[model samples]
Target: MPLTRRSLMDAAAARFGWRRAYGDTTTVDELLTEQSEAAYTEAADHAALATAKNTDALAVQPGVLDTRGRILADVLSLEGVLAGARSRSLPSEVVKRLEDVVDHGHEVTVLLAAAAVRAAAAHTSSGN
Candidate 1:
């Protein structure tokens, strides 16, 4: 089957931790403009869409191959964004979406990494 949203979510759940979504919420775009200081500046800002992009791009955390560390990166990245957004009072909806995306992204990343790890493990264990 193709990699649908359901596949992604399932993979994420199996590799990382489970995921849950809250009620409808605003998105990061709603809170900050593309040209806003937060969005443009290199500095870490919740209002900055760049920060969110970076978080998404970075995606996987170090040692995500290790089951124990699967969710750490996702949690930290999400927390950082949330902290920034909350401190700046970005809209509640923006905050909610940010949290949701981060959490889901974390799951996806960890799942992808875990699959790599499993492949490597199999290769090593099989001695070829």
Candidate 2:
């Protein structure tokens, strides 16, 4: 289950003995908010946690591949457009080679994206 702010606050109070006195709870809300913000800030600054989250997010979002692929495809498309606009100056062989490379790059990206999806599925299934 996903962690919630209330759960985090409860855990913090339990783990850190941060509870207030029975009748001195006037600032409890402010104190809890401060504690939660501090905890979140600390967690966010942890490099290993940040990296793990990023890896997991990337694994689950295969569209990341499309984002990069789209950039490459657009660049290639631009090359084609430029070639057409200056067909007299550009060599046909260069354009052909560019197209070939773009096609091969796309095939490779698809394979890698598939592999990433499989790895992410395996990771989730294993409860890691």
Candidate 3:
């Protein structure tokens, strides 16, 4: 599979602790372009989620360094995407995807943390 919007979204979901699966199929170029904003939103959501998880690291919380590192990496990845798109002169639509990711980062992170907690509960129960 080359890469589809679904695959991209799946990758983002998995990065944020989603246990779901994705199918194999590359999306057509036009569809992929159309879904660029969705893809970026997903990535931004995951990045913010990671950030929220690590936000309390300075409060004498143990085991936060690792998560904080993960958040840092996610932010870096977002920056890389923006830079790459700009340098390559990618379509305006592609660049437009990052707008929400940059703007609502903190809110997304908080939401992500809540989602992670829920997923953790479900995972634990399912394993039992």
Candidate 4:
């Protein structure tokens, strides 16, 4: 079965003990949202930098570099998560959830990286 966002959140909640609160008061959406806050912020930053109009190399380079570094770090962190999940013998469903999250992150990062490259190219060609 194809995994839905709810399933992913459920799996994460199960795997991470997010549902362990007294009376199970914490909702899956809240847990997922809390966990995703940093990632969402970084993604938003990447989108803004990618879509920015000003092509000054000096101005844009720092944002591009920062995005690149974050992407690399995310990749490494995902790898570690997968490795740890395997070592811990996590259920296949949970593993799939992790993979799905990583896949989406990769897609966003790739698009953002492409846009940053194009922006950088435009800056270079414009002699900015």
What TM-score, computed on C-alpha atoms, does each candidate reach? 0.38, 0.36, 0.33, 0.53
Among these predicted structures, which one has the highest TM-score? Answer: 4
Candidate 2 colliding pairs, count? 0
Better of 1 and 3 by TM-score: 1
TM value for model 1 = 0.38
* lDDT computed for candidate 4: 0.73
Candidate 1 at residue 2, lDDT?
A: 29
The TM-score of candidate 3 is 0.33
Local distance difference test, candidate 2: 0.64
Indicate the residue-level lDDT of 68 in model 2: 56
The digit string of per-residue lDDT tens for model 2 on 1-128 reads 12366557668888986752433554566666777988888967765654666666445455556555775677677667656745665677756776676677666667756766776777788787
Q: Which regions of candidate 4 fall more than 4 Å away from where they truly are?
A: 1-28, 31-58
Which clashing pairs does model 1 show? 26-93, 38-48
Ranking by TM-score: 4, 1, 2, 3
| Per-residue lDDT of candidate 3, residues 1-128 (tens digit) | 43475578778889998744324333455456657867897989877766777543232233333454566567667878778888888998878786446545545555556555655565566673
Candidate 1: tens digits of C-alpha lDDT, residues 1-128: 22365457757887877654524444334333433754456545534644454342222233334443546665776789799998999999989998888777777766767766676666567675
Model 4: lDDT of residue 117: 82
Candidate 1 ranges beyond 4 A from true positions: 1-78
